[model samples]
Target: MTAQTTDPAAAARPRLRWLPRYDAPRLLAAQMSLIDQSFGIAMVGCSLAAIILAAGLMLSGDRPGALPWACAMVVACAIAYFGRLRLPGRLTEAGAARYAHGMTATLALIGALWGLVAWLYLDVRMPAVVICILSLIAGMSAAALAVFSACLPVAIAFFLPAIVPVWVVFLATGDVEYLPMFLGTPLYLCVLLVFARNYARVARQSIALRFENVELISQLREQTARAEAAQHAAEDASRAKSVFLASASHDLRQPLHAMGLFLVSLGRTGLDERQRQLLAHIEASSGAAREMLNSLLDFSKLEAGVVTPRARPFRLQPLLRKLENEFAPQAEARGLVYRTRDTTVTLHGDPTLVELVLRNLIANAIRYTQRGGVLVACRQRGARAAIEVWDTGIGIPAAQHRDIFREFHQLGNPERDQRKGLGLGLAIVDGLAHTMQTRVTLVSRPGRGSVFRFHMPQAWDAPEDTPRPLAAHSLDGLRVLVIDDDEAIRGAMSELLSAWRCECRTAESEEEALAALAAFTPGLVLADYRLRGHRTGQQALDAIRQQLGRHVPAIIITGDTAADRLRTAHATGTALLHKPVVPQELQAAIDTLLREAATQGKGAPDRQAAVAK
Candidate 1:
């Protein structure tokens, strides 16, 4: 023989040659592990077997051989049990085969001792002794098969020896009366071995499955940890993006806001044809910038969830008419027909919110449609009315129907043309629809046209009557107080206010503004939302009220679009305006706030609080 390998697995593997090698080393290691744990219980069983054998002999009056045999069996059990106790707790790859072989031999030796006693302790003439030895051997072998079945080779080694010697001793007697007992012993051995084979197969499969489950659980935990880490990183990135948008929006809007104020103010001055011509071009550019900024503001407001709808019963007919009037001229200029169907339907929702949603839809329809017309119509559907916007300019593809509603995702404008817009129109529409508890559904075809529709709950009951405002008063002698941290914005606002012939006072900080409240009582207050010294316009408004001892109509102009800031400004119940406010919008906000103030009697009513003396 050439040099043999020292690997114990190679040497011990042949013991399992009768069975297929299914991961032989690991399977052997698993068997050895089971044997190591359950060996003590198996030894306890051997001790009981020893007691029964000794007791059977004494009862048969054959005490001579009985004591000696019992002593030998007990000694065998002790050596097998004690030898395994000193081994390592877990089997090593190198030691698994070695330990498996050792356990097998030790168990086989105990079985051999039991078989030897059967031959020595048998007394054929004494039926009690003969019956006791055969019964004891059968029970011992069966017990061995149960405990060592995890290692099939060890179970077979222990089972065969513990049983076959009894049959051999009885057959040698050649007594025809015991013929059946000796002959049937071989058949019984065959049956028990079959059961041991089945148990070992089942146990092997169970052990393999248990290992697989442990491995799977480990992998699942690793994947879950990675997913959680990825989620946290995504959240951090989103927060960072929001912060960047907020600061960039504020920085860019400051100068743009001043430009609008100055442009409108300069337009009022008498200019030559050339000067006015240059101004108109500059004004056009400013208007486009204002549009984009407004889009951003609207998206931020909606994302912040601050645009709560003040729901009420409003006539849908008037809203439809207003949209038609506004978009008709724009669509006609584009050589597209803009039509609005007449309906006497009333809707139970905030009129402002409904108008906003319709306005964006109609604007998108008109903007996208170049040749064909745009149609705005309403259909009654049971308790709801479906308002539809149909356009025939450039139809959207079916694939893009969902994507078109995502913010900053535009179709047919890959170059991101500013005139085509910032791609926030549909997104804002979707958001507004969500607030109204409705979904906007789209049906479209490429190269054809698209129809966008959403249902509004129908107001079956007629709307309760509400007061309408009187014609807006002129800004002349309005006693306005303007507070802004930006110098250019404050100057531009004052010039614009002066042109409108209003008595306007400007303060750069909340402190300066609050001090100014001493000599003058302001009919209106205009403050910037973000200010120096960590103050806000709302704070200034509150201080102004505390100072004058009366409610004052205030407007908070802001360039910041942070969600928290937007919510805070909106919750103040003051008129909040975005920066880069042109003179037209600025005047409109002022007029609306002042008008509402007059209607509600909110202006500084009486500092005197006159007492009837």
Candidate 2:
């Protein structure tokens, strides 16, 4: 039978077999087990019944002493049950099986005694066939039950009582046919005993299989739990790394910014030609280090999913112009041509972020190309434009093309001149492109060149607006207020402004800034965010503004990467810049602030209403 399901009712159902309703091995084993438990309990009850029956038989003049033997057998069966329960399975199955092998002779002697008493004392006339059948049935039932109950001695004891009846009945009748058939009782009993053992084996195997399945399921659950825990730990470590990088980047940039600003100012003061050249080299090295750090920080932010793209409508041409100028010198120094193919078309959308992406791509193209030109081009594709950087450089291998976009993966080339970079350019480009909802692709051959392209959605229906020109400020005679905690940075910034022909008033603290304001009302105010002894540049600027009794133009330079810093700077209505500021960038910031102040002053008192008008 195919036992497919674990349902009890299904198990109990009948199956087809061209043999007995109960097969030899399985039927005998189950019967013996059932009988063993039932007979043990039944023996006591049967002893009482036998005593009563024998007593009643004696009162009716049938038998008198039969009750004693029946009662003794009952006592024996009870003892067997108790003993079997205590006996270990090792002895019953292994030792008992071996011990019972040659004990049939002793069983025959017991059977002879039982039969003699039944015949002589009871005087019960019994047919040879009935005697033979009864003896065999009783012998096999008792012996099988005893074996099932793990009582090998008791099982051997049953054989004697059962076979003796057949011998007695056969001798009494004096019939040859009856003698042969009656003597065959033990043989028939032994055959059934063998079948009973087979049933026990089948049941044991079924139970084992069930337990094995349960164990397998338990192991699988444990493995799955471990995998989940490992995954969570990996994620936690990644988050921690991002947090550490974010905090450390801000701290490192602060000192670098102070040093660069001081160096910029030092170059302006009475320096010999060689000293001036050395300072210029220092400034270039500083710029490169700052750029690499910024790239790493941006990549970390992108990986942490902290950067949010600020998409706004603006002209794209100015951004393109700025990138062209930025890479022109590098291209010239590398002896490679750099040109803008077509940037005449106007487009819109988060110009700052878009420019950052294009800058990295174009810079990488220029850096990698050995002898050929790098081109930045824009081509209209349907409603959007495809902006591409094409370089005839040592291209990426087919296997490594996609891998290069991952963080910190660099291509190897011994013969080519390679720029030392942080390997974050393409990673940042990929991240920013996704942020802008643009699709970027790379097409290249191993040794030829690479073309990196991305599509920018058109934000304007018409051509972009031309940039407004800024009027140059005459700083020659203007008084500038510089407030910073660092003495070197304050002095350097003062010198830099002085070179622009402005009279600079340097203050190292809020008290000094207030005192400076009392002496001279400055045209522009430049302050560092962090000041000495738990002070801030904002506090100093506020004091200076109050002393001047007017809205003095000011800008805040900071090395703080936290959003709170930017929020506080914006709330103070100050133009802000991150540190490691180049001289030209600082000047541009100052110029822009002054122009805004001029525009505001020439308009209505409500700045918003004036701009709207």
Candidate 3:
């Protein structure tokens, strides 16, 4: 026998027709929420109305079943309402569909019970009492329509059962008097159904719009979070690049610094013209390399955000004179006349950073200008001084004015000329000026000249008690201790110090330093900031001081460009110098430290004598 085949598609189609279809999952969820929220209010309101209607029927001498049916309806509604409240907070789509179906069935059952009142009492009651009962049923149906309109099918399910039963009873009586009542009942239901359908459409549209808005806001927040993460990553990458540049600069400077010191010593030896000329070339090459490395170091430090300004009152005249003396020979060699107009104005700024700014500006002027002169001048403007560097160089074009201060941005040096510099001089000037809370302004025309100027706030003159310069101190018979991890650096320092008539004691570590100190007492300590065995120059200096029972005059020379190293060295309160140091600078620092020590020593003897007396 052939098996009776059931069409699965046909069966599924009938089930799908009964299931409510929504344009979006959120729309379905929203309708479900509305139903859940309004369920309790509708239940209580309809139940009370049914009780009141049942009481009125009894008072008018209606049937016994009215009171019992009304009570049973109220108890059923209470059970359904409270039971839903006990369910889970978040209802799944299938669960919500089941809820909607169950509520529709409950409402229909209540409507059918109300319809039973019309069947039993219409013939026996007075017309006034019957009309009042019908009115109450109509009112309750209206309320249900309004409450359940979020789902049209549910509204139709409750509405048809409530109104149709009354019409059916009127027709069954087969009397013309009940015809008008029967016709009006279906017509009134038709109007309510139309109203309920329109309301359901509007509600669904509003829910769809609300869901769209929520989705848009969620997308925006995700984009904003992504942007912030990208920004943080860029900042981290920039920091790493700066660190790499600093390390490379330090490594490059070490050998260059050693070469410069050896060259200075070699320059003093007697030599013929050709030898001297070749020596000059070597020195020039070394100097150029040093300048490039220094520029890179400055740019890296600025990028690392470690170049802090320490503003103090200081006379500019002495600083100007020093710059003039240092750069005069270079100007003469280039056959460019260099001039300076020094002012006795006391400016408030970090002296080292300000000096660096001025030096870079002046150097740029001399390097770029072939014929005309360069002038360094200070002009007074109210309570500020405008320190200006004027030069008849290859003036920058108006379009390229801002570009000149960018790293490796040069106007006419497309060949990457070493003599034209590494193109970081102006950049350094800009960075230092910014750190000093000032700005550098430039005025120029192509081929005419450029004037780079920045204002410095004038400070009150230093007190009269500021120490005056001591007489020139000699290095003869001075006791010096040199500590360095690099053997080349240690040997170079020993040779240079010995040449100056200093009794130099060299050591590679604290142990060796202490061993040397047993026989010789140092008048000055010069140490590299980083040493062997993870010890720093500061520690070496402290160790030496403890061994001697006195704070010895010390100088820290370093080739480290790390921000932490720079800060640590600065915090030591010692004269710190960067490597590839010029011979003149080294001698100047040494002489200054020794003179200050001598002055302090002179005061000590007087203090000791006073204490004794």
- Which candidate should be chosen as best, given lDDT against the real structure? 1
* Candidate 2 residue-pair clash tally: 8
TM-score: the better of candidates 1 and 3: 1
lDDT of 3 by residue, 1-613 (tens): 9889899998799888954444344466578688778888988988888798788878877468878978987987897788776656435654665666676777777777777777767662377776777888788888887788888777777788778888887788787877888798889988888898898999888888887889899888889889999999988876786677678877887787778778877877898999999999999888778778778768767755767787888888888999999887899899988899968788888888889999999889998898888999999999999999999988988998899988778888888878788888888899888888999999998899999999999988682344776666799998989888778877777778877898998988888988898898988887887788899888888888888887777777888777667666666667777888887778877777766666677311111010000
Across 1-613, the per-residue lDDT of candidate 1 in tens digits comes to 7986587888788886775332377777887787778788888788777877887777767477767677777777788788766666436656677777777788788888888877777778878777777777777777777788887778877877777888888789988988888889888888888888898899889989988998899999999899999999988887787778888888989999999899888888899999999999999998788788788888888878877787888888877887878889999898999888899998999898788888888888887877889999999999999999998868887778889999888888888888999899999999999999999999987767889999999987889776875676788888889999999999999998899898999999989998988887788888888888999888878888888887877777889888898777666666667887767667877777666556667562322111000
Clash pairs, candidate 1, are 257-580, 369-393
Assess each prediction's global lDDT (C-alpha) against the native.
0.81, 0.65, 0.79
Residue 354 alpha-carbon offset, candidate 1, angstroms: 2.0
* Cα distance off (Å), candidate 2, residue 178: 14
Query: Per-residue lDDT tens digits of candidate 2, residues 1-613?
Result: 9866586666656553322232233323433344444545554553454455455555655455656765665555455446545544413333343223222333334344455445554332545424443543465455444443233333445544655565455567666666665566556556545544454455455545665877898888888889889889988876665556656766777678778767866765799989988888988888777887677656755664645676655666667778888898889999999888745565666776788889889888887789888988889887788998999999988888789898766676344332458677898999989988886799998779999999887665664455677666556786788888777677667767778888888887777888766578887777888887778887877777677667777777776555445455446656666676777777776666666767787311211110000
Candidate 2 residue 490 C-alpha distance from true site, Å? 3.0
On the 0 to 100 scale, the lDDT of residue 391 in model 1 is 85
**Poorest 10 consecutive residues of model 2 by lDDT?**
604-613
lDDT of 1 at 223: 92
TM-score of 2: 0.59
Q: Lowest lDDT 10-mer window, candidate 3?
A: 604-613
Model 2 C-alpha lDDT versus the unseen true structure: 0.65
Q: Which run of 10 residues does model 1 get worst, by summed lDDT? A: 604-613
The positional error of residue 433 in candidate 1, measured at the CA in angstroms, is 1.7
Off by over 4 Å in 1: 1-39, 64-86, 91-99, 175-180, 465-467, 515-521, 543-552, 596-613
